[model samples]
Target: MKILVVDDDPMVLEVLKHSLAHSGYDDVTVAQSAVEASQIIAKANPAFECFLLDMSMPEIEGDDLCYWVRQLPQYASTPILMVTALANKRDIDRAFAAGASDYITKPIDMSDFGMRIQQIDRKNSQNAFKAPASISLLDKQDQEPDRIDFSKPVHLGEITGEVDLASLENYLLQLSRKGIEGLSAFAFTIADAAKFHFVCTTEEYLDILKSTGQIISDHLAASGFFLSYAGSGSFVGVGQNANLHHDEWEKTERSIQEALAKVAVPSSLGLPSKIQVFSGVPLRLNGKYAERSLDILYRTIVEAEDRCGDTSWAQV
Candidate 1:
């Protein structure tokens, strides 16, 4: 595939080009700025198949450039992956909102990059064979339910084997009362739960959920955190010394993605499964609002879910 990579850092550009080349992507073009990328796009007879953009760039930022590329008729649905060092939730939200298909944080992991590209290729291949009418039909069928039944009780052991939602909330309340430092809550959900349920057997779907919960539990447990299944595919985690550092969060996110990617379903399922993880760190814990820790945690998870579409992550 013809790929265009845009980045201002010479080292990053070289490393990415070398990595892509090593991965057998020979028709790779490098651009130092968005302006240069635009020029390349304008002059090409056959358009680039995919884009790797640096989120932070001179002239036009990657997110803005992604938006601009989507505006072009030829590139509207082309995969545009954001390659950047910005790992915060806000940056991720902006990138996706502005039309990024996927994102990779810097100091790139070439193996992960290859897997992501392969996924995009598989999706594009699947899409290429689909008729427009059928595509429309599937899109309509996948529309989210107007009301989700979050009140449904989930057997905690059947899912993540962690504590129930009420227990998690009580833990958070106790921590708040004791004046915990560096407390952070994280929420995770299976992004393609609707489709998974429609396609896979109940046993298979539950297995996937169990694996997902274990992955999250294992990762958080290393940091001495507590995790719980919050029903409707949502999992919440509370950590006292999460430190709220961007690098730490990025590492955790990468671990989650790696674990999820290993999960295999039938190719007939025709869609990639994904997990959406959101981190909520309260910036203030003073005065009357301090007593409402559970409320804050719930709101943060809700905000994270609202900000992230299917197969994405965000922080609030």
Candidate 2:
């Protein structure tokens, strides 16, 4: 992938370029500042496919630069990875919130950096966001929308503080670094979402998910949570205050189902579709998570979700 890297440090830039070359990424262009990066991007022949931005810059910060790139028409969905040494949760959050696809810490680990780069490159190609003009169910269509892969997590374009799964992992990783106290994770699944996927077109299914995510976001917004659609009917969230309540989940679910009931399912064979949302118990992120892989945390979430009955609530 063609990469444009922006960093103020000269030696750091050389090291990054070397690392990219080690990973077989030869088409790299480096810039000393965000302004220089913009100049390079503006003058490039075949527009750069990916970006590596330094979170800490002299003039314009990487988070602001990321937002600037995201505002451009052609590069909306392009991969933009933040390169930073700081682990302050607020800074990291701002970077992701500003549109960073993912981040790699400074004094970068060659192995982990390579993997992160490859993953974002592959993911960017796989799940492209359309940034819907309206939340209303798919606009009237002459032909049916394409079939959707119910299990593949797509890029939820900034829907109520939504970030990609990779950024979510990084957020968790940063949380672990500073002791995971007062942190908890929760998940909710649309009980019969697969059935909806069968009845709705790809675009229509996405509409349902976006709407569901919006409600969940609004409900969890009070808890200060970052949400992501984990596909397969599951929407997962991480909250800093660790306030996960049974009544709140029920209320959120009811709100989602009530809203969905109004959306007419175009291909439902005239059968009124009913939507139900179920939540699993919240898992506390404590010492165990500090030493364990974030992947296992997600697995624990899946297990917790599996323990969920129609009305049963499980605990960590």
Candidate 3:
């Protein structure tokens, strides 16, 4: 696959290029600035398949460059991985919001980076072989209005790479049946999500959803949480008591906010937009709610949405 690596740092550029070459990607191109990258892209015979961009640069920020790259018709759906030293949630969110497909924080982990590139390569290969019927179906879905029907359960594939609510419900049910306790569930919703549909294409909105899911999953991964899309720009996450404490939950909320802040609506849309999240009170998986865990979770999501008038997060 043809790859493009752009970074102001000479050492980083060299290292990335060498590593990729060693891994058999000999068609890799290197750029020191956004202008250079643009020129290279314009002249390339076959376009680059993937881009690895540094978030911090001299003149044009990597995020801005990413946005510019996304505007190019041929590269709209191509993978752009942000490689940077900004490991904070806000920076990561900005990268994704600017249209990055994935992120890698520096000091670079060559092994992990290699694995991510391989995964992208595999996905591209798979997509190249998609049946015409499948493509047509996806095209049809894209033409439809961007609305989520909460009455019916959405397949896991329809949203981000999170498990379905049914899966989370089944696990909770099993835990209840085994008399295990100390599990808690929380619901999350994206504030003013409908406005996104009005401003962004279906594909862009879906990217926002997937990025939001990834932010939540990364924060809750260490706590052994089960996160699933709860329909209509909402998510449900279940975690143990240790991870559901007031302090931990607060940290998670902050992370979510930082990530969402970068997901902005286009200025051309002529509408003020922001990516605010509303989270409900943690519902302990005990007492009367044990048997109706999924129901309780869904209700909590509704409650959170209702209470998220002008706030980043809602408590209970």
Highest-TM-score candidate: 2
| Winner by lDDT | 2
Per residue, candidate 1 scores C-alpha lDDT tens digits across 42-110 of: 897788889999999977898888889876767756778888888665575567656566767777778
Candidates 2 and 3 compared by TM-score, better number? 2
TM-score of each: 0.44, 0.79, 0.49
What is the per-residue lDDT of model 3 for residues 1-316, given as tens digits with 9 covering 90 to 100? 9999999999999999999987888988999999898889899878889999999998899999998987676776677888888865456546654666777778888998898889889967875754311011234445744344333333333332344454456455544544555667787777765565456654566666677777777665234466777666677876665355667766777788888788755564544466777776676666244567666666767766775663332221
Model 2 ranges off by over 4 Å: 118-142, 177-180, 245-267, 270-274, 287-316
Candidate 3 deviation (Cα RMSD) = 13.4
Local error of candidate 1 at residue 31 (angstroms)? 0.6
Choose 2 or 3, whichever is better by lDDT: 2
lDDT of 2 by residue, 1-316 (tens): 8899999999989999998898888999999999998888888878788999999999899999899988776677678888889777778778888878776777788888888888877765664464422223344765554455567666656478787666677777767765546667777777656666766767777777877777778666245577877777778777776445767656665666677666655556732365566666566766335546465457645753464442321110
TM-score of 2: 0.79
Misplaced by over 4 Å in model 1 are: 131-316
Predicted candidate 2, C-alpha RMSD: 5.3
